[model samples]
Target: MLLNCDLGESFGAWKMGLDEQVMPHIDLANVACGFHAGDPDVLAHTLSLVKQHQVTLGAHPSYPDKQGFGRRSMQMSEQSLTNTLHYQIAALEGMANVQQLSVSYVKPHGALYNDMMNNPQLLKWVLQAVARYSRSLKVMILATAEQDKHRELAHKIGIDLMFEAFADRLYTDEGLLTPRSQPNSVHNKQALLQQVSQFHDDNSVTTNTGKRLPLVADTLCVHGDNEASIMLIQDIKQLLNT
Candidate 1:
């Protein structure tokens, strides 16, 4: 399976993630647009890294919430949501164009992603935005129990879908990610590697309640917000390679 990470989250002097260090280890870089964390320079530098590492780029868009880090849900009218998505995707595509690179997909960030998964109308808007932007760009989403349902919707919207499983996040018995607000929502180093192994070896993951849930995923996602997570990312890469 291909590995992906949320990179380019660092904003101005307030840095976040070791993007320069972790870029080489990932297959896809979900580089954040300004709304969540990244600034113009950060986006440009990240695109350069993607080119340097020969990694695919994907636009990581979110609600216009730098304060909550795009983790807090926000309500928006359909037109406004559409405009918001288009604005973010266009920003990344424009910068990528300068480097002779292109974004292959769009992954809604944090609350926008979780909200889209749980709300059909919101997802339709998201798909429509991506479809309008460029049908060539796929929408990356969580791999859950309702794969067929998601696929059917995306098909109707005339956009492709890429389902990704989190390597460092806890899963529920239903195959959805454990809410981050919960205790132990994220895995430790050993647990993270074990989860990646399970995804590689079994096409499944052990949920928070210790139940094995089958997952058909197109890609695996790992975090790299700190030095420790960066080491865990290297271990995950090695584990997946094995």
Candidate 2:
């Protein structure tokens, strides 16, 4: 029942969410490395805030496309993709070491994440990189009954896996997240709160298609880019605690 947010997304002159405001309510902070939307200074600052708030730190690695903010997939060879992932993880690990903190997990960002779930070859590469670089760190995969193969592969490889459900996103009947292009991919606070209540009560999620799907997950994701996300997170935490 941990709540996780993507932080340290501000790169260079561009600023992102209010990490400090959101950190207090969250249990985990997925800090972005340079591959997607962060810099070394941002990483250092974010790590300090996470340490102060006692939130578990996770690495948010993405494809090396910063322009699209790693939301767009790149057509790279398997070796190239693996190499980039290793590089990003290592960079974050080094930053964490500087602050005497260790990364607790890894969650691929944006397109890389979606691709890994649907493409076995890419998934294998990501899993291999995690094993080779940060073997002890858990990989957070999107929760879905249809993607059990990815979970099985992780277990077979001896890598710890964590299933994550999106608190602000809609799901399909098959238990996959609704595509961002869809009209109601993201939810408002009221809808999100209602969904959270249902999930807390029964571990079930109602998809956009009006089908109920049983879901069991260790963590829930709240996107940093959403404007009202911090308020939503605070409310959800209160609801869960009560």
Candidate 3:
């Protein structure tokens, strides 16, 4: 039932969500590296805040596309993808070292994450990069009911895996997240709370189409960009505590 949020996304000229206010309620903070959104100063500030709040720190790396905020997919060769991930992870590790904090996990951001779910080659490359850097750092991934080959590969490579579920997103009957392009992809605060409560109660969730789906996750993700996201996160924390 650990709650995590994507934060530290503010780039040089552009600003993002309120990390200071949100940090107090989140148990884990996924700080974005420079690839998607964030700079050295922002990462340093985020690390300090996470340390102050005693929240676990995770590295959020994405394809090198700051223009689209890493949401858009980019065609990258295997070598390029591996090198990019290594660079992003290294940058965050450096910042964490300077703050006397360690990165506890790695969560691929935006398109890169979705790509890894279906692309075995990409998943292997990403896992290799993570293992090469540090096998102790856990890789957070969306939970799927069927046996996940990538998850098995991660474990075989000596990297810890943290299965994650989204609190504010809808899922299909096939154990995959509803596509964002669809109308039912996102959920309101009350709906999200209800789903989370059901998950806590029965370890299952009802999809938008009223299909009961079993889900087991070690961590839940709450996106920071949504306007109502902060309220939803607060409600989730309150409910989980109760």
TM-score of each model, paired residue for residue = 0.96, 0.95, 0.93
Expressed as tens digits, the lDDT of each residue in 13-77 for candidate 2 is 88999888888888989989898799978889999999899899999999998899999988988
Stretches of candidate 3 off by over 4 Å are 147-150, 225-227
Candidate 1 residues 127-224, lDDT tens each?
98889885479999999878889899999989999999998789998778888789999887788888888889998889888988889898998877
- Name the runs in model 1 displaced over 4 angstroms: none
Name the top lDDT candidate: 1
Output the better candidate (1/2) by lDDT.
1
Model 3 lDDT tens row, 1-242: 99998999997777798888888888999999999899988888888899999999899999999999999888898788888988898898888988888888899999999888767778778877887874468888878765366567887887878888888789887667889899979887778888889877887878767989887888888766655777777788889888
- For candidate 1, the 10 contiguous residues with the lowest summed lDDT are 127-136
Model 1 compared with the native: what TM-score?
0.96
Model 2 scores a C-alpha lDDT of 0.86
lDDT of 3: 0.84
Clashes of each: 0, 0, 0
User: What's the candidate order when arranged by decreasing TM-score?
Assistant: 1, 2, 3
Clashing pairs in 1: none
RMSD of 1: 1.3
